[model samples]
Target: MIFRHTRLIMGTALLAVALPAVPAMAQDADEARIKKLEAEVRALQRKVFPGGDGRYFEPQIDSSAPVTTTSSSPASTTAVTDILARLDALEASLQRLTGQVEVNSNAVRDLESRLAALESGAAPAVAADNLLPDEQPLPAAAGPAPTPPPAPAASGPSAQRLAAVQAIAKPQTDDPGDDEYSYGFRLWNAGFYPEAQQQLAMFVEKYPRHPRATYGRNLLGRAYLDDGKPREAAPWFLKNYQEDRNAERAPDSLLYLAESMIALGDTNRACIALAEFGETYPAIAAGRLSNQYEANRKKVTCN
Candidate 1:
């Protein structure tokens, strides 16, 4: 669990850092080429997991058969019911992780936008070459060398356009009102999960509808994950997923939910989570889900 949480943080950071480079590096290439590559990757992923959509980034899971748990006494049944209830809570936590992943995905998009801005802002090394004036140098022999025309200065509009592009290409600014969220993230980055959780919880409450609410929830889930509380993280991740269904985070939420279930020794629900991840985000499902699926399958009770 600790390793998983660390990987999640590193992955998010890497994605955020890498996205901005795409536009800056590929500016000279045809836009069609860029889109084509993305399309090709999406297509390939979909092909790998037949019937997969390219929208979300969920992983696949095993779908062989359901296992039946035998319980005789009423107390045994009630305990089973309690386990199922815990599973429900786990599901909810995963939704929150989904939201955080979405926020990270959006950040990548924003970075891409900034890269485009950088590409567009780069001015030509030299103004349009004046062939007529430069080679001839001034026709002194032809006539009284006309006053060498002064070089034309760049227009104001061009300058303004450059400034606008540069501004747009810069990273997103921190929200002034989200001080607590900021603090929470800082603590999370520093490995203080408990303090981070408390701060993040307050941030969610104080700014329930703020733009960073999804991110806050996501961080909260991460806090739980880092604390080795996958079950607690499940509901938050799930909430994040539902709130932002199309976000990259949704599939991630599903993935973690399944993991949490497996950890709690609930193979059936884990499979259910994995299957849902594949169904909702097929493109991502097959590539990321195999290991978890196999692991859970080994523990299955049903034939």
Candidate 2:
């Protein structure tokens, strides 16, 4: 199903792209290509709305196959763009449905654990859901009175370590924002997830126009993920990917988005992200991001 959405979008995008640059070709070849696209669209509709009336929806590709199209035909291109937008909406709906499924699955698991505990005469499963990766702990102040006290504050060298790393690194470039971002990077690299998140978040918010802002945003997501909080991480990665698909760190954001989704038990969405990364950034996927993407794809076992 995910692949179907990807193929439909990419295929239609290809049409919008190929239409403008099509070489002078035999009329029949253009017709054949349009025919293939039309067929794929129909197949997609049937798969998407199985056992439903086919007449309710149809691909809007004109059969004439204007071979000399330029970028000027905004009216004609709008329909194709709209089709792609609707496909994206459908994909979003599917992801929401998957999230609901995950919630339901977790509920069932909690119930099963409770029943097992009863059978064995063990402690109640009150905190079974806490064991779930996607379950976020309440804020310390918001937690129940019975909740365990927050961990003792860092002390001695630990306090020194935290305060010491909070200072920004020396400026490597003219941009002080770059140094601020490096501070977050150093924190993350040193395994200070919470501090890294705070630092990166401030850096991103304060210097939204900085060259390293994209890097800052992506690193913020990494901090959350490293802190075992994928729910916190996924949105930042997604925002970076959606906001600036061509940014230097955008590919990393997309890949990390997949990893976070997988961690959160939403392999359906993770698979979609993985497929998008492969489709939209094939070169990067085959180059620097290849290993991580491959490992993540294996985690989801994407079809």
lDDT of 2 by residue, 224-296 (tens): 8888877667667766765688999999988897888788676666766788788789999999989998899
Displacement of the residue 140 alpha carbon in candidate 1, Å: 91
Q: What is the C-alpha lDDT of each candidate?
A: 0.57, 0.69
Worst 10 residues of 2 by lDDT: 140-149
Per-residue C-alpha lDDT of model 1 across residues 76-159, encoded as one tens digit per residue: 579789999999999999999999999999978865553343223111112346443543321211222122123256633366
Model 2, residue 278: C-alpha shift (Å):
0.7
Which one wins on lDDT? Answer: 2
Model 1's TM-score against the true structure = 0.37
Q: lDDT of model 1 at residue 105?
A: 99
